[model samples]
Target: MGFRHTLRDDKLYFYERRDIMEQRHNYLKKIRQYRREDRPIVYLDETWANSHMAPERLWLDEQGRGGWKRPSGKGQRLIILHAGSETGWTPNADLVFRSKKNSTDYHDEMNSEHFLEWFQKLLVNIQPGSVIVLDNAPYHNSVVEKVPTKSSRKKEMQEWLTRKRIPFSDKDLKKDLFAKIQLSVPNRKLYATNEAAKACGHIVLRSPVAHCELNPIELVWADVKRYLKVHNKTFKLADLEQLVPDAFQSVTPEMWAKHCQHVQEEEERFWEKDGLQEESVEEYIIELGTEDDDDDIEVRDIEFEGEGEDSDGEQDECEPVMDENDRELLRSDAVSDA
Candidate 1:
């Protein structure tokens, strides 16, 4: 059986890698199209940390003998933090609370209760009716298994959100204080809404799978990890605990804006480096055709067979190939065939 599998693997190994790469290229192109049409891309991901003392070891002349010296007392606990952001430079984060505890509680603190509260705050901060993209994590999508005989936490939270419109900012102020209130009750337009909890004038967008490039948070993580490596390489768990906040502080709005500008330049450089033309205003006008030229060209969806080309490790799909001969031939062919 192993021999047969090996034989099959040998046959597979002989196949061109480009064929497999092309599939991925097409997939990414479709996703990019969706994103361009969709506004406010949001990214959600998890980060881990341990409570144990930092491991210490000296570099030895010996080969591969490094070992961990387990520390006595408590190990590290996992905290799940969810963050969302828009293209327009707005961001918000919520730490999940696990209702129940384990040997080491890896869940959020308030679980359902806290999640709703945090979500409400996050939504209100971003403004209502804005689209938010998030990852398909269990915490985001997991349906709380309810006890048939008892009320589930999920049901309770849902009921509360539905009936209650929490006041923004100050709790002491009356709910009817906002000028945009409809009659006595506050306008639904004032608060943010999630995919789970739908309300008036709210849009929630789910992030595309396997497409980290679309998420601005990827840049945030890159900056974060870079900051940690350069600033906190020798730091302990306690040091890290302090370092995290400091590191975040270091990444000010100015720094983030600079990073984003750098990203745009880098993207342009990449295309230029790969001998691909940077997308221009003229190109969009030429490709999509002018809005006034309704009779010149008909706009309709057609199944385009994407031809991908290699650019470093990633496949570049939908690269506009400027071939005058090909364009003329295609036009001529259409005219003759018609």
Candidate 2:
């Protein structure tokens, strides 16, 4: 039969696309469903250090808090990793430790190995649930090796053939090991990380791409930075090691609960507007594009390889959308209560 379309008189075919707001709505709806169903869920994300050094700013508590010296200028960057659950903030870690591998500079970046090490530590301790809220970042994914197939080297192919219980015996299998092995098609099966997640009891809920508002941890970062920007007087890397964790601790459990509720409100807005924000409508006029260069909070994505690929040769590549954060404007009310 030839290709067909709109055959029934009662219906017509139309291609439709969900706008960004609608996409956000869907993301929130799904996560809420997980919560509604009482699924174990934790929001995981990372935020890097920003360039908000004070030529100097610090707070001295009337309660006799010690003072910090102001720096003349800037210093090295840092990265922070942590997770948030409905209960509260998870213990946080900063990437300012001297690199075990390089030993020259601080651990300023995250990779598959770094993420995996963190996951191994996290997975065993997680609540008995089946979801991990990871963004579409490459570092969050890693590949697993596939079992060798029949088309193997003499030794490997024979070993695989024996294990697969193919018709060939010791002698015939030996002959086919190095000889030309043929079949109707190539058995191109590569590994992907979802399998490992399945084994670990997670259904990995990935956040929508380019949507930071959907991640509650985004709110956490905003609060944390508000603290760091105020307390960063010494502008010393050693001082940051102390300041970063303090900021992470500043976010109360109530704040995380508020973030979850705020996301629900956003979802409700989308649902009521049918995902049509005024400016999001196709015919709406817009101003010329300009970025808020002074914005301190920046989210970046890095790529990681997935399980196996098809028989066809292809490789995963990184996205060049780097968030090279520049200097940040100090908060208007920096020196508040220490």
Candidate 3:
């Protein structure tokens, strides 16, 4: 009776997986540690903007016949990539280019090579010894050398082992070779981005899979898109291109600080929640049986309400509140661009 009808949204199947949980906990902990150490934190992500991106609703006359006609379809798109910290956007780090294909997902427009080039520019502009917080995008996790998985062919796995110089008998079966490889490389695989960041005296902290809310840059993207939606008059590609810079300029240092603060609050909430969950699990195990009494006791399942939603039972809108100064800044930038 308390439930209300709402639209259903797809969620990642592994949102509550044990490995994901551990990864999230580690990420939150590391972020806290980095903050305590006074290390600069930069959030990076990619987003796309359609040429015809405009507000879905508009005012009409009393007869509801005065609204302008909307564009027929989403026209060309622009893929944007950048990194920023609470202080402000990294200088010379923004990358905006027309997308070649009209792919549904923005990631399809980005690949390891493109990302690496942008990342190099970001590395040069960001503060030294900064902690770069990145989402688990495929491009962000390009491995230096891909480790063999069960899906890999037997010969492929064997060749990888041979390359790694891990001893393996010629007669070993696929499973045996795989087991040996696992034993030899039990740690998390190395990523080229991580190595590159480390080389530049920066650290890369990857947000857990499907945790876009953890990256403040996502909030920045929302602000940029909102600006576009509110001011997109023509819905023309040329006009949209001109508007993009002003949209980004609307995001001020104060706004970036606010977004970063919100992210920190979310991180803290997660840290506390993880602690409580661990305590609950420990309490459950103790109540069930002692460690010595290993009689295959089945633990009671625990469920969290609104597992993926924020504290208010809704996804974080992070609606930007622009003051006069912010508006003036955007106007000035637009005028200058013109």
In model 2, state the lDDT of residue 196. 53
Model 3, range 1-338, lDDT digits (tens) per residue? 89766632223323454665766776776777778789999998777777777776789888898667766767788878888889978888888888897555556788888898889888988888999887655566676676777667899888998888888888999889988878887365567788899899998887665566688888888799889878888878778888888988999999999999998888877778778332211100011111122122232221111113332222232222234654575668558856
Q: Is candidate 1 or candidate 2 better by lDDT?
A: 2
Give per-residue CA lDDT, model 2, range 1-338, as digits (tens). 99565432210100022333334455656666777779877777765443334323346789858665544333455666778776786544233342233321122256666776776556655676657776655545444432333334466655555565655555665345434333421342222334455667765666654445556777787688678767776566677667877887799999998997786676566556564322322211111111211111123222222111211111111111212321111122223411
Candidate 1 lDDT, 1-338, residue by residue in tens = 45332211211221123432232233333334434655443444444334443324434547865544445543443343555443333455635222234432233332344455666656655645455554323344322232111122334433333455633333322222322122433221111224333553444443322233444555665455445445544335555556555545555666555554554464344334434432322101111221111222222211111112211111111222334653565567558856
lDDT of each: 0.38, 0.51, 0.69
lDDT of 3 at 252: 96
Q: Candidate 1, 42: how far from true, in Å?
A: 4.1
> Which residue runs of candidate 3 sit more than 4 Å off their true CA positions?
1-18, 65-67, 166-172, 276-338
TM-score against native, each model: 0.40, 0.55, 0.73
Alpha-carbon deviation at 59 in model 2, angstroms: 11
Once superposed on the true structure, which residue ranges of model 2 sit more than 4 Å away at CA? 1-29, 50-74, 91-108, 146-193, 274-338
Q: Which ten residues in a row have the lowest lDDT in candidate 1?
A: 282-291
